[model samples]
Target: MSALDAATAFAEGLFEELRVNTTDAPGITRAAYGAGEEFAHARVRAAGRELDLDEATDAAGNLYLTLAGTTPQLPGWILGSHMDSVPHGGNYDGAAGVLAGLAVVHALRQEGRRPERNLTVMVIRAEESTWFPVSYLGSRAAFGGLPREALEARRADSGLTLREHMERLGLDPEAVARGKAFLDPARIHGFIEVHIEQGPVLERAGVPLGLVTGIAGSFRYRHGRCLGAYGHSGAVPRAYRQDAVLGFAHLVAALETSWDGLEREGLGATITFGEVATDPVQHAFSKVPGEVGFCLDVRSESEGVLERLHAELMAHADGIAQRRGVRFEFGARTGSTPAILDPALRGELAQAAGRAGLRAIEMPSGAGHDTATFAAQGVPASLIFVRNQHGSHNPLEAMRMEDFAAAVRLLLAFLAGRPA
Candidate 1:
């Protein structure tokens, strides 16, 4: 097998290792900063050591494994993605990207061909907000952009603050609290992330890889609630009832209407309301529900679109509140800004793909990624999406080994300044 092929095989082995160890019945669970994440980190760290790479970590637990370049003084390149997975999520969502970085470096070693500039594989922490409700938790902390209050945010399952988790892992949460940045954007050459397309766009297009144009950003309300007055179901008349469920239904219908309008106007965004529930303790079949809780996720690539949606959200909520005699409260919102990727870097990768005879498509990513945090810091960044099946965030999510290999070869070609 070629060096790239061998490296690809090595990556497959690591994938199996991760799956076998982190299995949670229905799917894998690599909760942000949880045991599964810790296991994956340890596995990657061992791989770095085996490769004899220079290893370093930031105060917030972002791992960096470096293959030192010949010209050490030049600004270096970084290939990375988060290692955390959502609860009962597929194994490859985040792990594939990090492992791809390693495969590239391993290929370089096998061929004894190192780039002129340093290449670092970064394994980011806590990208899945299912654990802690914060966007780009690790990348933001690396750049000193994470809010100090985020440390106090509790993980959904563990019910422990992020600071406490860091403390348990022997990381310096106080340094992150003091806003110490490990990365200086101006000093880096570029950032590239090799991720599986979280959607089926590429699969539908019959392409192996995609050069991402931009990443969508979003505002999320994880603890949103609609409050109303409870009454006996039979006794509450339609006009006199203050039904929180009805108020929620109104908001959903109104936003969906606005969403349809945007689509007709050629605007792109997604509106999702999950975790909808009525308090089981206080709710009953024979009584009107006094309150309903939900999680709101709104995403868009355009800032204006996001602003417009936010305006529509408030307007609809106000109308619903007045009509249904209920109040809406969205507590402690968290979000990231949409990022337009560096086109020059993207063009380079396209050129590499062309010379390697690999078909690649240029597309926009609706899902958020760590690459956005790099782009937000003025660092030129590219997100390479490998084709996959069944989409992401589920056990059925799948990617062909050959497609992943195609992405690795493309990165290698980009580094070598020639076809792979």
Candidate 2:
């Protein structure tokens, strides 16, 4: 069978598998180490076996399927992406890359083509920030990026500690620390990930594919406090009240102002207050001390810029706390991961797209991804973005079938020495 024919068949099966395996709810609930994720892992292993690839699992729950090459001495090439999805995420985000990897393996097998280096496809878990406090859990573990105290941290929503949860999921937290899940630095020659654009840039520019220039790093901060008396709405005097809500509002405004300044400087910095909470109903007649907290997400393309912004935000947070008369505490949730892309690999991907007769554009990814983690590990990594509709993350999210086909074809051209 031709590579196109093989890819088509593989894609069809992959789409069906995703549709059938995922929940029917409006949003995806495949949280890290959840049952749905385990099912998906089983399916990936099955696909690998069908293609006569050897499958293995790491201590961090990352799955790897390897197809041996004719030159046994050569280091392997890796094609990877996470399989977990965000809540209410579309089918394409991480799923498309995984399916494309499967298709590549199948095409190579059909043609009896052995590469100079071994080829491995990886499906990493916990790319989404659902279960673990940090994102890219699997990739971080694979790269030995997890801190020693991280395993002891507890999820706020669930009483289970990180170690307890990992144990429940049949993973040894200590083993993971000992590099049991670590990748062989010398064995991986290059890495590639295919993902949906998750934004409208490519589609708006009328491009079928994007050669990702860099993946943005993220800096997350949680600021807020357990503050003074919430009193009766009507009875409390405006002068004598310690309002937690007012304090939170001040912090939020400061964050926005900081972001605005960064934007004016052309720093490409973004800040999002994703969560906020307060205790005790405002309507209650009794005076009760309430807690207020909010998350700040700052991202940028440069590490130095990110660090500078982080320091500025911290300073502003202190000022806000003092002015508001609230005892505020700031916690660093996740540190920055600077933008990194392999220049040579990016050029190769662009050349492949041109050979396949696909319109490709160079773009930067605003969101953090497993590709960033791999790049941090010194792997030559690149990303391919397929067109997405309106950059939506809802269940109704959709992508053009032809675009997916084009991406797969371009990938084939990159892998094999043939125009798609």
lDDT of 2 at 88: 61
Candidate 2 residue spans exceeding 4 A from truth: 155-158, 226-228, 280-290, 390-393, 418-420
Model 2 residue 203 CA deviation in Å: 1.9
lDDT of 2 by residue, 204-242 (tens): 899888988898888776554536566666677777666
In model 2, the worst 10-residue window by lDDT is: 280-289
Whole-model lDDT values for every prediction: 0.94, 0.76
| C-alpha TM-scores of all predictions | 0.98, 0.91
What is candidate 1's lDDT per residue for 299-415, written digit by digit as tens? 999989998998999999999999899999989778879999999999999999998889999999999999999999999999999999999999988999999999999998888
Local lDDT at 149 for model 2: 74
| Top candidate by TM-score | 1
Top candidate, metric lDDT: 1
User: What is the number of residue pairs that collide in model 1?
Assistant: 0
